[model samples]
Target: MSSSLLPFILFALVASISPGPTNLLILAHGAHNGLRASLAPIFAACAAAAAIVWVVGLGLGEVLLRHPLAQQVMSWVGVLWLSRLAWQLFRAAGEPLHATARQRFGVGSAASLQLVNPKVWLMAVAVIGVFATPGLPVWHLALVFLIIALPCMGAWALLGIGSARWLRSPRHLQRFNQLLALLLLVSAWSALLA
Candidate 1:
């Protein structure tokens, strides 16, 4: 790889793997639902992310960026939507987990979030703005992002699935859920600000 491209590779990896709301949701879901059940949301998030990269790389993001009113409206909606999800997760944390998993966040629900998630919007815009070149085919750049990002996102789910064996106690599990809830709440606020 060219040294010039190293930063983009590192940025994509770190950004995807970082504990944002999406990854946190994956972790929470995977921990409770097991790997098999968690597949829907994990793939949903990946699909949404890749879609973002594609749209932004194709320069459609400029249309949104040009319309500040549209951007602000989406940001507020994102805040409200995320706050609602965080509230539900927070309340769920109080309840003890059962052997049968509650499959709440499915493919449609998770994929729709990309529309309102400011972090996703920002990441997509930033990646294209910084790394995409005029000469390169936009889809190729988008594919690079997809290739690097999807697997990194999957790792968060893996961590959660792996932890299922370790956090066997009810109390430990409750605490973990509560903490994830708090983090998700914080992420929602941060997304609003971003």
Candidate 2:
């Protein structure tokens, strides 16, 4: 409840809500499936991200960041994963919601991917290194993460659900899927360049 914690919580919320690979994927899932289906991945992602934040907060992230090769490897992995996702999205045009939901990555798999996802890693590092106070209790940090990340991510998922309403026809859905795929590809490229 300290004033110092507020900034960190807000920062975490902002970062979580911002468009990124994870959010994009969740949005795609929600649009294709439903808001309920999106929840699994969102929870998984948040849990995974929280674990990374906790580890990094304990000082492991700094060590990982120091290795240039590691960062490059992560970048490449992220690009590959996202590219694959993009391909799937492109192919999902005109597909049934059930098929799309089945094809969507599982929560655990998506969560595990965060380890190699540059955006998630960067967010984890920032949250742990910048927002979290060194002397503060661990529970406080956990609370901050839960308070901020859950709702932010949930909102993104909800957006996808809302978008689904607009896509009534197969052609419209196809175009929407293609656009998302393109966006995912661009995001992957951006991550690689970063």
Candidate 3:
């Protein structure tokens, strides 16, 4: 391992492991579904985030920086979308657990969430600005992020799996869902409010 790569690796680990909207949603999904079901979303999310890093490094970050209005619009849209998800999670708290996997959070939704995920874009910008050496390819950083993110996000899924055991009862599950919803609501709104 080159010494130059260590800091970037640390940054990627922290960014991926931290509880953002995506991580929260993944944890919730894993709890609702299982590890097997969580795998697709995990891969999708990691890939999407890596893609964002690559694109942002390539020039999207410059475009976004030049347009404050665009950034504002994106932020508002992302917050609104997150708020909607939070509401849905809150509503699910009251509903009885149906055996049908009708409303499961899948790969497509996970990837789409990355498009609107402010955290992802911000992290991409930071990664480019700070870690992207002049000689290093953007794809190198993207690949590094993807590699570091997998197990970090997977840890969240494992936590969800463990929590699933504790959340067996309806009352417990309801409380857990409600708590996650509240957290998601706060997280979604805090960036704009700050």
- What does the lDDT come to for candidate 1? 0.78
Number of clashing residue pairs, candidate 2: 0
Per-candidate TM-score against the hidden true structure: 0.90, 0.89, 0.95
Model 3 per-residue lDDT tens digits across residues 38-116:
9999999999999999999999999999998998899889999999999989888855445414678899999999988
Total clashing residue pairs per candidate?
0, 0, 0
Write candidate 1's Cα lDDT for 1-194 as tens digits.
54436787788888888888888888877777777777777778777887888887776789878898888898889878888888777666645455426655688887888778888888888888878775544676667777886788678878988888766777778788778878987887887785
Two-way TM-score contest, 1 vs 3, winner: 3
Candidate ordering by TM-score (highest first): 3, 1, 2
Error of 3 at 6 (Å): 0.6
- Which one wins by lDDT: 2 or 3? 3
TM-score of 1: 0.90
Query: How do the residues 1-194 of candidate 2 rate in per-residue lDDT, one tens digit apiece?
Result: 66668787777777788777887888887777787777788888887877777787777777877886887887788889888878877887788565666777678776877876778777777776666665665556766686678778888778888888688777888888898889888876876786
- Candidate 3 residue 105 Cα shift, in angstroms, is 0.6
Query: Best candidate, TM-score-wise?
Result: 3
The CA lDDT at 73 in model 3 is 95
